[model samples]
Every structure is written in structure tokens, then in C-alpha cells.
Target: MISGPLDHFRSGYVAIVGLPNVGKSTLLNRLLSTHLAAVAPRPQTTRHRILGILNGPGFQAVFLDTPGLLQPKYALQQQMKRQIDLALKDADLVMLVLDASRPDPDRGQVPPMLSGRKVLAVLNKVDLVRDKSSLLSEVDRLNKEGAAEVFMVSALRGGGVEQLKAGVAALLPEGQAFYPPDAVADRPEKFFAAEFVREAVFNLYGEEIPYSTAVVVDEFKERPGRKDYILVTIYIERESQKAILIGRGGMAMKRAGSMARRQIEAFLGRPVYLELRVKVAEAWRNDIRFIRENVYGSDRPSGTA
Candidate 1:
């Protein structure tokens, strides 16, 4: 609880931008003190721009955890890049997260969109760094390159996160609060439900199964006095992939469903009856209509700038 005058109230969007596996989602979860975004080892795990709000006294920071920047190979990847573009357009400040353990520190280069914005270069995963001098050198190099400020922290271990939060709050411009203090995230429960299921698929499967798959919550019915019933359909590119997902005698599907159900239960704070089905959508990632409908959903209309 920070004490400040009404005139000093600050509220604005801070876009978290970075390359794949750079710990952007982990940093957001750490800042909000809740797991709003799904964390997995796989690249492009985050498909949408998730907004997490942090309110303290007179400040409210709307943090946008965006999809990792990468070269688009299909329509789905193009849409993912679009989401990042939108976040960049709406951001009041930008935080470029980088993997500090990498030998080449210059890889943390700022993107064209972030060129004139208030940028903070965050060197994440400092816990993995053994030499303190190398970390300082990396920070200094980033600072000299053009970042308004450079911060070193381990988002996974909660190290230097409090200081990062304080620094963000101080940099925000004075404005009205964008959301209620009690609100944690802007996305609905169903969006996270599908994400949890997709995460389970990524965790349970190997090879191309995770990348070639997408989870759609066909039905999410909540009963007042009973456990919630969620029906999800997993989309795959081929029948062979379907067999792999279902496994021998349906055991694989059962395991994945059980794991997803437990995750949903933990997230919703109630028991859930989850039903999963697999469907073949050949090269759906390259289909524009499917990408717009299933991936981005209706909230974000197609061709949005």
C-alpha cells in the first residue's frame, strides 16, 4: 500500500515484449502474484496478449504479456505477431525481456516498434548466472544501447521482482485507474480453460503434436450446486497425430484429460468434469478463417490494426 495524493495516481499499460523462451509470461505472473498466463518450456506457448493488472495505493499498472516475437511461417503465427503489434500500439511503456544466460548480450536488441517509447531492458533468469561481473557487463551494454533503464531479476525465483514493480510504478504517468483493484486479469475464465487444456497437451506430448494442436472449449457449462462440465475438442493436422494423442487403448487421452481437469480445478477453485475429443483439421494453422475464429476468438476481430 503506497501512500500518495489523488493527483499522483498513475495508471497505464506496460507491454512485455521479448523473444521466445525469454520468460515474459513468468515475469508477468511474478508481478501479479498469480498465474494468469500459462508457463511452459515450448516456444509460442502464449498465443494471445494477456493483460494482468497490479494496483497499489494510487497506481495501477496494466501489464500486457504478449506472444514471443518470431518469424511467421503460417497464418496462425501471423496472427500471433498481430497480437504483439496491437500490444505495442496500445502500450505506454515497453519492457524488453531477455535471457541473460545467453553468451551474446547484444541479442537483446530493441524492435522497431519500441523505438521512441519508454523502454526498460530486463535481463531475466539472473539466478542461472554464476558470475556477477558478466551480469553487470550485460546490463551496462543494454543501458548503453538505448534502454531507459536496465533491470536484472529472476522471474522464476521471485528475485528483484519487488524492486522491478516499484520501478514500474514510479515511471507510470498519472491517470485514473483502468480497472477495479480486485481484478487480476482482463481475460475470462473460459479463455484460460482452453489455455490450460492446450498446456496439458504440450506437456503430455512430444514432437509436432504440441505445435500442430489447438484446444477449443466447445462447451463450458456451470451448475450452481454441481461441478462445472467442460467439453473441449483438440484439433490436430492428421489422423496419425490423432492416434498419437489418443494413444494405445485411449490411455494417453485419459491421462491428458485427467491432468487438464486438475489444472482447471485449481484455477477455478472448484471440481470440473472435463471431456476431451480429438478432431482432424488438416493444416488449420495455415487457414485464415480458422486462425481468426479459434485462435484469436471474437473479441479481436479479423484485420484489426
Candidate 2:
């Protein structure tokens, strides 16, 4: 046991987990006060374990924003599950973020591999619940299920977020900081470039296009007096998909590249020359080896910044 008041500093990993489309990424972005994780209206938008380090006055809470836990349907999904498992194994505490707007989502059950760990139930999207009584009932239900604590907040609107942050700090074990104050994420800008491009793909197309796509930053070069050069490839499962992405005379690919470049500029606070290409990788989603080495290269694409 920690004995002295001087050892009051707290630092630990908090795994933020939930079912698909529960606003886990939104909550991560809200907590970090930055867009470190990718967010979209679609399920399974986050395919990696994105870290958000919140260095506060007395404590440092490293938040691991994981992909939604679900049954693995393909190699990509299986890898996503592996990422979640990694986070769960490393977590000092588990924040089970659930959507308050969803019907009967307050199960309050402990997630897999989280046995005997401190779990704080975050009933997010409270703003969507017009009936306050039902929300209270959800809280009461969680209490009955032996939750460590239940925090209500709207991650998108910033309601009740500060209180939740403080509550999280109090539960973390006392230790020194793991990361410096200036650092907000564990990933490089090129990693986010790939993610932002994928997000743009999600935003642009419908049906099976987004799911069949994987983005890789093939190259990133900084110029002393010119726009930074970024070369990216959008890997699709079929030639037909590539045709759709490229569109008439490459207009579609140009549009996605332009959209992603603007987002990357905003994120990096600098201009970039983005080069986008689409390639056909047949059944790559089912190829676990390719997914591991190429797409998720050390949590980023291979040979990239």
C-alpha cells in the first residue's frame, strides 16, 4: 500500500470500451479536448486502439480508446478485437461507455478479461434522453449491478465531462506521469492522415465502399519552404470498387484526396501536397497477414512517419 501523502500523484491507463456506435470515439475526443480518434456515423469506424493522454494538475490518465467489441466476422475485425484485448490487458481501470439513448443498453455487466478491475460506467448521450426518470432508473440499475461508479455525460456537447474527468483521476493509482504534458497522442501525424483519409472515404461513399477500404500513407516528406508531400494509397477489395472510388476521369479520388488533405492540414497546422491512389487488393479483409504487416504496421502503415 502507498503510505505517504507525498505519493499522491496518479497515473494509469483507462480502457474506454463499448458496443459499436456507442460514441466511444466521441467521448475520447471530448476528454482529450482534441480529435485524436476517428469518428463517423458508421459502426466500427475505429479499427485501432487510439491513445489519448490527459495530463492534468495532479494526475495523468492515459485513455485507450478501443474499437467496439463484437464478434469477429473477418480478419480485419479479428485484428480489431486483438487491439481491444491489448488495451484491456493493459488497463488500470475500465470505462464502459454506453449510449444512454439506446433502449435497455445498461446491462452493467463486466466485459471480458476485465474481471476484478475497477470499472466506471459512463452513460453517455444523456442529452438524448428527454425523460430524466428513465435515465435515473438506468443509474439505479447500474448501482444494483455493483458498478464502481456511474457517470452521466454528453461527450459531444461537453455536459458533465469535467466531473467525469475528475472522478476518473480520483480512481487512478498514485504514480508518476507516463507522458509529458505537451503530448496528446501516441501516434504520429501520418497515422492520423491515413485515418482521416479513411474517414473521408466513409463520409463520401455509401453501401460497401467504406468497409472494403483501407488507407496507407506510402510516403510523407517535409519541405523547408514548400507544402509537405504525402503519398497515400486507398486499398480496395475489388477493381469495381476502385473504379467507383476513382470515378469519372479520377474526379472521385481527387475529391476524397482534397477532403482528407484539408483535414490533415488543420490537424498538423501546415499545408500538404496529398497524392492519392486506389489499388485492388482482392479479399485482403480476410487476409490476416496483410492486415497485420501492412495496414496495421506497428499501429501504423509500414515505412511511414
Candidate 3:
């Protein structure tokens, strides 16, 4: 634990922002010491803003794992951008996670929202770098450019994570804890259930199939002693895509379900009876009403499709 003054209990929101596939979600999970965010090698795997509360002896870090920054290609992508924007606007501190192994580390520009705020530049994937001098030079360049502080860490291997947490704890303002110590994340189990299914799709499929796919939990029933029952609907835009997801003799769907069921069961700490079905939604991503209700939840007002 990152120890600090017990009288000064600090708490604040820290938004993890970066370009796609920069290991933003992976870093969040590492910081929280648990898997609260879904991660994959593909870009744009995280579409929603996930809140992970990290509580230690005298500090609470409310970390927001947001969708990676990207140009809006469709209504769904636009909604994802909205999630990023909202996270930036609400954050007390911004942690910019970057892939340090990239050839042109200077290409990663800081967002306009982080202009005057306390920004922490996190150079992730340090384990991939062969030369330590080059990594130090890149860190110096980033710190000289704008970052208030810079850290080199390998999120996958838990390297330099404790120091990063200590740095964040020092920056956090004194206040009350936003969430209870035991709480890991703010999202419900059903939300993670849907995310687990979607993650499986991304891992199993190839090409544009994962990008066009979305999973919705139709039914989630929990029993006292028996295994929990879950019914999920996988939405796609075309009939051909549906056929590809289902596969010949339903083998592909079976593979996805088997992978997702094991993950969901681990997440919920119970056996899961998962049922999957594919349906063609005919460009549901372009429909504002559907995107608002299904993707971002119905609580927010519908925007232009």
C-alpha cells in the first residue's frame, strides 16, 4: 500500500487517457490490483467509461478507465468519443498512458483538456525496450514537453506500478473517500458480463467482425444455490456476419460462449449457464435511439445517429 499521512486522507478522480492500444485499460487493472477493465490487443476494445476505486490506508484514487481517443467514424464511435470527453471534463487529474516502444514517441500529443491540469505521463510497455537510455530520453522529452510528472512502467508485468501509485497519492487532494474500501468498481455485474462476451468475440474473430459486433445481456438470473443463468444476444449488422459468428455446425459460437462463460464465472464467483444468440440489427450503430439505449444506456438523451 502507498502509505501517507493518516490525517490527510486524500481522494480524487484520475482519468486514464491515451490513443487506442496504448495499454490504458491494462494499466488501470494493474493500479487497482484487480481486473476491472476488459483488455485486448485490438484497438477500441473499451467503449464505456469504467470507474475503479483504489483505496489504501489514507487515500482513495477513483480511476476512470475511458475509451481510447479516436476519430468518430460512426454513431457508436461518436458515443465512445463522448465517453472520453466526459471523463476528461470530470477528472481531477489526467494520466496519459503511452506505448513507450513506439518509434516516434513524440507523435503522442497531449489532449487540449489536459492543458493546465496535473498531468502524469505514463510510459507503458517499458519491458519491450532493449535500450534503457532511449527510454530515459523519451521520458525526458515527454516531461519537458508538458507532463507534470513522468513514469516508466510495464503494466503487463507490474513494473514501477507501486511508485506510480505513490506519485498519484501525493498529488491527490485531501478529502473523504468516494467509495467504500471493499468496492472494486462502480459498474454492475451484468455490465461486466456483457463486456466479457464482447471480449471473447474480439479474441476469437478476425478482420472487421469484432468491430461490427456488440453484446447485450438479455437476461441475467441469479439463484441462491444453483448456477446463475444468463442469456446474451450478439448484434451484428449483416446476415453474412451473423453466419460467420455462428460458424459451421455452430462451432465458432460454441468457442466464443465457452471462453466467455469461463471468464464470466470467474468474474461473478459462480458457475454461469450462458446462452448466446446472434441477430442482425441492420446498422444499429447508426441509429441514435438504439445506440443511446443499448450502448450508453437509456438514462442519457438520444443524440443524432
> TM-score for all predictions?
0.94, 0.93, 0.94
User: Ten consecutive residues with minimal summed lDDT in candidate 1?
Assistant: 296-305
Which pairs clash in model 3?
A: none
Clashing pairs in 2: none
lDDT of 3 by residue, 89-116 (tens): 7788899999988876344556675788
The regions of model 2 sitting more than 4 angstroms off are: 1-7, 105-108, 300-305
Q: What lDDT would each prediction earn against the true structure?
A: 0.85, 0.85, 0.85
- The list of candidate 3 runs beyond 4 A from truth reads 1-7, 298-305
For candidate 3, the TM-score is 0.94
Worst 10 residues of 3 by lDDT: 296-305
Candidate 2 achieves a global lDDT of: 0.85
| Model 2 per-residue lDDT tens digits across residues 1-305 | 12223348899999999898889999999998887788888988998888889987688999999889899999899988988888887889999888888885435455655657788889988899898677787778766665688889999999989888888888899898988988888788889999999989988888899999989999999989999999998999998888899989989888888989888998899999999988888989999877987678856432111
The true-versus-predicted C-alpha distance at residue 122 of model 3, in Å, is 0.3
